[model samples]
Target: MERQMEPWWKKSVVYQIYPRSFMDSNGDGIGDIQGIISKLDYLEKLGIDVIWLSPVYDSPNDDNGYDIRNYRTIMDEFGTMEDMEQLIEEAKNRGIRIVMDLVVNHSSDEHEWFVESRSSKNSKYRDYYIWRDGKDGQPPNNWGSVFSGSAWEKDELTNSYYLHLFSKKQPDLNWEHEPLRGDVYQLMTYWLEKGIGGFRMDVINFISKALDLPDGTIHPNNLYGDGSPYFINGPKIHQYLREMNEKVLSKYDVVTVGEMPGATTDDAQIYTNPYNKEVNMVFTFEHMDLDSGPGGKWNVQPLKLVDLKRNFEKWQLALHKVGWNSLYWNNHDQPRVVSRFGNDGEYRELSAKMLAICLHMLQGTPYIYQGEELGMTNVVFPLLEDYRDIETLNMYKEKMEQGISHEDIMSGIYAKGRDNARTPMQWTSEGGFTTGTPWIRMNPNTDEINVEQSINDSTSIFYTYQKLIQLRKQHDIITHGSFQLLFADHPSLFVYKRQSADEEWLVVTNFSDQREQLEWKDCDVTSKSREIIISNYDTLNTNENTVEIRPYEAFVVAFKKGIEN
Candidate 1:
């Protein structure tokens, strides 16, 4: 594919906000658009160029608004369309772009279209969703929902099973239907016309289901079957995306990003290839799964440094010449990076800064999930009752029936639970959020690790992030440089170089607690009179031909051609 002119998004840093956890305006306890609008200046101070908010679309609160019931309306809890419009305009005044979450993979079962479809078998909206007959007394196939149980939910009224890859409240739409596709395109146009910046497509890869609707490989000792191969990255996905670009997205100068759960490097290249006109970039789960065990996310394991280096090397190299990558460590669906990959105890601040340096130094657009800058940690809810995510609740029930002990499940919840990231934004201990109760409790360590404290301490993780973002803006090499791994086999050190025509930058990171050597002799690039540009540590340790990296130390240096000390 031919390259096109680089867009503003490629050079912009994105901040993701889980609206419900950000802040609350009214005493009702849920976060609203007015809350987000009030925090616009705070986000601007953090130096974010784009803000991507998770869906606030009309919904029944199942799956946290992923089950959108109305494309044009805002959820009642979030406020009205007027509030959203005000948010867009206010954000623009601060030079910040607002990217809305587009969750068309499914619609809430309570949606008007779904209600009409379920009314009768011959309804005009009947074909808007995927419907099939049950076999004998079971669902259409052994496909299981991501939450739990069968992906096919029986419609008691229509006597047919409607497909729901997630919670039963979310029914998947059939992309094969011509009129449905037209409707989606028109909906996108409506948003662009309203002056919204762009869209962050939710579960976009699952839109085109394998038309055959066949049985899947069943998992022993598990309720759901592995039916992902049939629907994920389906055959006509590219066709559908290209059609989307042609019909709606390309008309606006805004950026588009798709959340692809199982997309590969090749798929990402095609999707973001400007010539292909699919998207500007994509969020892939390849790097995030490095610590996953045999049972997947819940069954967690220690992050292997080799596996991590390999994952980054592969994606960086594969996309360096073709597509672009989106760098991130935490999101609404995942736990905090410091707690998951770094030391959350004695070395929390050091490790958080190191992780930030390592990811931002790469050749890609970097995203900062809310609270990540404050070095926030995962919340370990004591009992299952405290959890709010649907997936977390279902996993507890399914594992309990299978005889897994509560202690074992809670251990996994501590490591991989979605609630870990859903904790209320720790602005302050008291009225920073609301006088009312938070939808979910704030992280108990708020007094020590909140925005109020971070903003005051110059050495805090928040400032470190600010410096990294500023570096991206100041250096062209950061946006368009080629990435090369220096120590691919090193277990503790993650070292790489980004180079353009005349500039060279070396990024060295110690991802562990042990102090390590720079080992310049073993690396690919030659040593120069390098000036240390950024580092987590306040002091530098240098020797004859190498530098000593303290525990969890991260530093970036600019290399000059031939200067001798």
Candidate 2:
């Protein structure tokens, strides 16, 4: 097939709505499909074309809706099928396309397929999931679940084990089963036919597993092994995606973004290359993973600006010519970015806007999580009992077992817990989200930080995001520019340049709270030809010699037409 023309997804900005936290129309304390439908006008004014709703599928809420029991039905807590249909119609009326989360990496163990597969060894659905004989008297291998403990759980009746990379309630599907692939493809087509614009594939790359089930190498202090090698970007992942593209994706005007935790730019290029027809882009956690300590996500450390700069530059440069990227900092699985990467105290708004600039300046599609645009900081729950995330709870239990202090584990949770980003959307001084009570406690600072306040204040972080999205829509430099990292080793300064054939844009952000001087003379960008385009602070000065930027001050300078002359 010939290359398809540049599509709407490339030009549009996407807003991700974690359905459970966005709003509650029924006063049921949980955000639902109708809640989302009620907020389309708000999203339209924010200028996002695509709305990515996280899974509202039927589930046991074991992993907060990521575990799917029925692929086609809506969760009872969320709403009914008619509510989802109205959501689609209303969003379409407002020029917004809806994209559902595709969670096929695993399904809820309650799903009929898993139920049948687990019933008897000779069942027709037994091969639909990965099953293996126990090794000696233990789990099949040393593989550990991503949530915690062992990846394999033995069925008492069958005396065999089934694999679950996540919670025990979610079983990994067997991609080697051609019939299973057809079923998934058929479900995808069903959604596409219903006017669902596209999909944000959940752990899409993990569908393929290694042919040989081998024990992973063990870490020194670990009880089990790192089982990522057994599933992450395994041998058949690309082939499976290509087949998926040919069968479902390429047939419609749609966009597909795969969530790949351990993939590199080279791997991403193949997954997103237009000619290859696999996906439109891939979300690589290389930049987001910067704050994780060597032990991984639970062990949080200070984020090194140099490391963050390096990773973003590498992916931007690597995918500049070959493919596409989906840029993000806040997501359901991550802590609030402003809390993790920015100063949340006196300079909250300044630092939040600075972080936004630092990422949005890159050449890629940007995703704004539900409350990210309002400069939402992490929730501070003094007691561990206040937290609700399964990952956070599991980590706490494991750390307590390891004899770590309550303060130490809570410190890590404060810095990197997924619950930090899962709080309900602050929509009013009182009642826009819920009437009686919210599912999660509302951040007490909502009076000053909610959507009503942000929308009223012209200088709020919310409006800054609006301007950023508008700029993206109007500028081709954003869509087709090549990236160049300005100062790779700057300790407190993060600077980069985006260049097209005739124009160049320089984005400078001070990641720290200290004032810094830009040695523009160090780079070839002549100061005389540049014009200030965007900045968080009102005043920034560029004299003949040095450009002075204030604490957490951020701005973009664009080289005008014929500046080189």
- Please provide, for model 1 over 225-292, each residue's C-alpha lDDT reduced to its tens digit, 9 standing for 90 to 100: 79999999999999999999999998899988899999999889899877899988899998889888
Worst lDDT run of 10 residues, candidate 1, spans 519-528
Clashes of 1: 0
TM-score for each model: 0.97, 0.97
lDDT of 1: 0.88
What TM-score would candidate 1 get against the native?
0.97
Evaluated at residue 296, the lDDT of candidate 1 is: 82
List candidate 1 stretches off by more than 4 Å: 1-5, 524-528, 562-565
- Candidate 1 pairs with clashing backbones: none
